[model samples]
Target: MGACPCGTGRDYDDCCGPLHAGVPAADAQALMRSRYSAYVREDADYLLRSWHRSTRPHALAFDEPRPAWLRLEVLRHVATGPDSAEVEFVARYRIGGGSVVRMRERSRFLREDGNWFYLDAVGG
Candidate 1:
């Protein structure tokens, strides 16, 4: 099996695969990593399902010429509250024949019941 797209250096099945297969993530960080893996796999359904209803869009659509996601570097993961957390990461990608672009964001997540959901970007 190939390495997981989340840069975990582990087989997909051992890493993000189970999360994609309907298993609940153990923590907010796992959910964040799985969300990145979902983007790499182009799994819009999983993304939407994992998103907080308050900020989730009606749908998710990849750009016409999808960007080639290269790598992910998680810079920080902090538990802001008993049921809230934030993860800051840098993701590099390249659009059709374009130079790689590095995008960074600090995303917030909240746990409702026992499932973690992505809330929104913390800051620009």
Candidate 2:
């Protein structure tokens, strides 16, 4: 369960610690990846923590049916500035019946107080 591409060597905590602690990522791309990891792991805390307050929901529940996350692929990343960035990626997964599901999204981020927060989602 410790393998995560977000570069958090000791699972989500040791790797995306700052990101989950409300510390903005140094760039947009980093934030996007960390959020993806959060979803795959069902780490609602991390998701809520990284969401921009203006758009963040009151609560995030991940206790529903679970999906078997297969792989994460970061297709492209573009940074306009320290405070703004976009990432396009695909997250693949599988559930019952050997079915495979893929989620693709172009994510946006904003930097605040030296941390990156997920601002919004574009396409999926």
Question: Which candidate leads in lDDT?
Answer: 1
lDDT of 2 by residue, 1-124 (tens): 4567554345666566557666657677778777877777688988888899989999998654677777777888888685688888888877755778888998888878777788888996
Q: What does each candidate score in C-alpha RMSD?
A: 0.9, 2.7
Best by TM-score: 1
lDDT of 2: 0.76
Worst 10 residues of 2 by lDDT: 1-10
Stretches > 4 Å off in candidate 2? 5-14, 21-24
Task: Please provide TM-scores, in order, for all candidate models, with all chains considered together.
Answer: 0.96, 0.80
* Tens-digit lDDT track of model 1 for 52-82: 9999999999878898999999999999999
**For model 2, what is the alpha-carbon lDDT of residue 112?**
80
Ten contiguous residues minimizing lDDT sum, candidate 1:
115-124
Residue pairs in collision within model 2:
8-15, 24-115, 24-116, 25-115, 25-116
